[model samples]
Target: MVADFDTIDININVGPQHPSTHGVFRMVLTVDGELVRDLDAVVGYLHRGAEKLLENQDYRQGIGIQDRTEYLAQFPAEQSYVMAAEKLGGFVVPERAEYVRVICVELNRIASHFMFMGAYGTDVGVFGTSFIYGFRERERVYRFFEELTGERMMYSYFRVGGLAWEVMDGFEEKARALLQELKRGINDINGLLTRNEIFIARTRHVGEISAERAIEYGLSGPVLRSTGVRWDVRKDEPYSVYDRFDFDVPVGEFGDCYDRYMVRLEEMRQAVRIVEQALDQMPKSGPIMPEKMPRMLRLPAGEVYVPVESARGEYGVYLVSRGGNHPWRCRVKSPCFTNLQALREMTVGEYVADSVVILGSIDLVLSEVDR
Candidate 1:
């Protein structure tokens, strides 16, 4: 038996300025009542020609450009660029520098996850509590960053073979205290949001994707982890001092928005553990940068690619050197750009409101996408 119902056509432009879009992103949607029939994500409102401009700048100056490409995860952006140059120039980073790199990068990863948790919660009507809580904790971490690097957000602290500056006195103690505070704060936030019936109702079982589909669509980070894959560049392909650190890669049972959220939470805990270990074993005195790194770096004529685990996913840098101070070509493999591809699949049959919620769960920064 079938019941006849009236059908109505509706078309809407969700945003070029919606908060849930995470930036100036527009989505065209065709709907029948509350259900979305079709949607198209319109991007490129934030493009800044970063990759094209890198070819004209020296290796050292080009890092500032990478900072703009993924503003949220600036350390990893600089790391990827420097790693590419290190591989091409055959420079060996000192052991101390490697550990410092790992520590800084992991801390930034925790900060980035906090942002996702906060912003995603707001997008789904959980109010601004999560955002407020997240930023409160994020500020402590950023203070540590400012103490060490002299910049709050875009820190150009990572150089060719080492850091631009050493960790200040009392930095280890501050890091230790912050890690403890973060552990406690994470527990509080988890209890507040992870088990809430309303929160689960909004996120659980939504935007489901299998591990196969995630890989096919080039998804990474929590999006891939949500699909039950334990693949992480830090664990599988060791970089910096990641091989020496003890940590776990959190994987989810189902590929849903809730699972992604949980994976990121667990990952933040793991990052805290790694940071504690680095603090315990940190070298007290050493040169932050390599002794022999040339002021004007010139690489052998060749191309090399270096992949690093950023907060979002595996960010890779492709560099072509023509035996000059400037690179002949540069290309950044931004995770947000590829991760956004799965959005259509995630939102196709869901309600209009769920579209924004699912998009936030994926956590794509427009700068990274537009780069």
Candidate 2:
């Protein structure tokens, strides 16, 4: 016989389809009154086993598959895989190609952050404000991407050695104009959300985590920065011509939902700055792909790990080559997987409704987590 507590118990299923869960994620919540006593995130409803699938496909073909893993941050996924292959294969990317990759990845970061902001706002009951603002800014970035890669979402633009496509004529000018408008829109969004008293009250002290705890949980990007750690893979690791750019890694004093939200908001501004600098300093001419780029890329027998500062955080890809076109083994270290581990720690003792806000603040993609 089990001893039952005097307090009432209630069980709630958050979702396999909840808007706040974000992409086929479900959570089983055990609550007493409004307080969440125990929480379990049930994932794998979206698992496609991308790593296993990649082992059977050619290197070029695998890039397209990686795009679907984290659909919102497709550029970084592709970038991480491509960089891994390049390192393993000893391919040298031209200066122009590196600059182009930087611009694309940073722009994608803004788009990903926009999606997070919109979803997070809805989670907190600020219905339409974040949605309108986020997608409004996202449209400009998508337009630029559509023009360059001809695909808005699943862009397999990044290849093993360089890029699949080159920058089109007048692309620089269009990118500049789009980024300028985006900067203004970011300011307007900050004024609308960050300064609002209600927004602050809802998130300021909620889902609080210390810098020590964040590091212990292997947190990165805005989540870690929100705890006042100024670590960024782009700056610290310096891959794909990021070292040439001048930008600040924004940090927050409090590690709360609001702090994470604000840190990402500021990160968009920094991304815009880096994009502008990349556009100005980009080389005039070079081969987008290597001169001897093979149609079937076969790497020497070895392993390499590449990490990129994705919109989410440190997105890493580890590849093992067996002197063949297909990788012997491939692994993706998705940030969402590690970040989601911190959820129960953040959510316990908070209200059930606040769990949604907490999840939104973490900004996990179920595909990435389950992969």
Candidate 3:
């Protein structure tokens, strides 16, 4: 029994402007009726020569560039960039500074995931309710960030050897209170979408990728974890003070859109745990920066690469020094760009509408992809 029709495949260009494309991204989709036969993703429309630009900026000034490169999770970007310099210079970060860095970055991870849940809710057709719920909690974190760092979004708070300055007064009280609030917020978001039949129908088993394929594409963060891969850089490749924290790395079995959503939801809870521990273990009083630091930082001739587990995935910085205040070459390893590579593999053979779901699940920041 064969039923064949002479249907012509039509090409549709989605974005560089389309709202669902997530950023200034363009993808040419070859469609046969409602099915996606092929997808050609077009990036670089938002490119700003971030790496080349980093070469021109000094170590201190470059924190701002890292903020923009992964704006959604600026702390990780700033952390990676600064740690590279610290490594090359053999600088020691005080214990208090390490704990503070962990706390702030973990909170940033929660905020970034909240942003994803908000936007991904819209993509899954839950629209305003999830968007509002997600942002409500995100705003709370942002307000705290503004108070501590003096900048809401791109807080270049991290410096070469340590923090630019010690944290604000009542840092522990505020951070612990914020963690409690985030716990309740995570529960709220969970209740909103976790059991919703429509949400599950839309996301469950849609855009499925096998664990092996996910690793093959160099996927990381929630995307790779969703595929049942126990490969979190925080746990497997202990950076910062992550080795001291005991938080579970969430993974999913099906490796579908639903798994991605669930992984991020659970990750938020784990972030809260890490923050609480960091607050408890942090030194009561200490210097944020090391003593006897030179006015100008000039590293010996060498190269070093430092990677941190960002909200997205592995945010790494490769620094090449020639004994100067500025690096000879600065390279950023962006997880979004690498994760986006699997979009075509995930989209082809799925419904055209599911393409939006697939891309949304990636939770990419255009700046990271274009950086």
Off by over 4 Å in 3: 1-3
Error of 2 at 188 (Å): 1.9
lDDT of 1 by residue, 247-313 (tens): 9999998899999999999999999989888877878778878787788888899999899999999
**Ranking by lDDT, best first?**
3, 2, 1
> Ranking under TM-score, best-scoring first?
3, 1, 2
What TM-score does each of the candidates earn? 0.97, 0.97, 0.98
Q: What is the Cα-based lDDT of residue 356 in candidate 3?
A: 96
RMSD of 1: 1.5
Q: All models: lDDT?
A: 0.88, 0.89, 0.92
lDDT, model 3, position 48: 98
- Please give the TM-score that candidate 3 achieves against the real structure: 0.98
Clashing pairs in 1: none
Q: lDDT tens string, model 3, 1-371? A: 12296888899999989889888999999998899999999999889999998988888889999999998999999999999999999899988889989988999999999999999999999989999999999999999999999999999999888888888999889988888898898999999999999899999999999999998899999999999999998999898889999999999998899999999999999999999999888999989999988887778889999988999998889999897888899999999999999999999999999999999999989999999
**Least well predicted 10-residue stretch by lDDT in candidate 2:** 1-10
Residue pairs of candidate 2 with colliding backbone atoms = none
Which ranges of candidate 1 are over 4 A from the true structure? 1-3
lDDT tens digits, residues 1-371, model 2? 22375777788998899767888999899998889999998889988888899999999999998899888899999999999999988999989999898889889999889888877788888898888988898888888898899998888999999998878899788888888888888887888788888788789889989999999999887888999999999999898898888999999897999999989998998999999999999987878888988888889999998989888889999999988999999999999898888888899989888999899999898888887
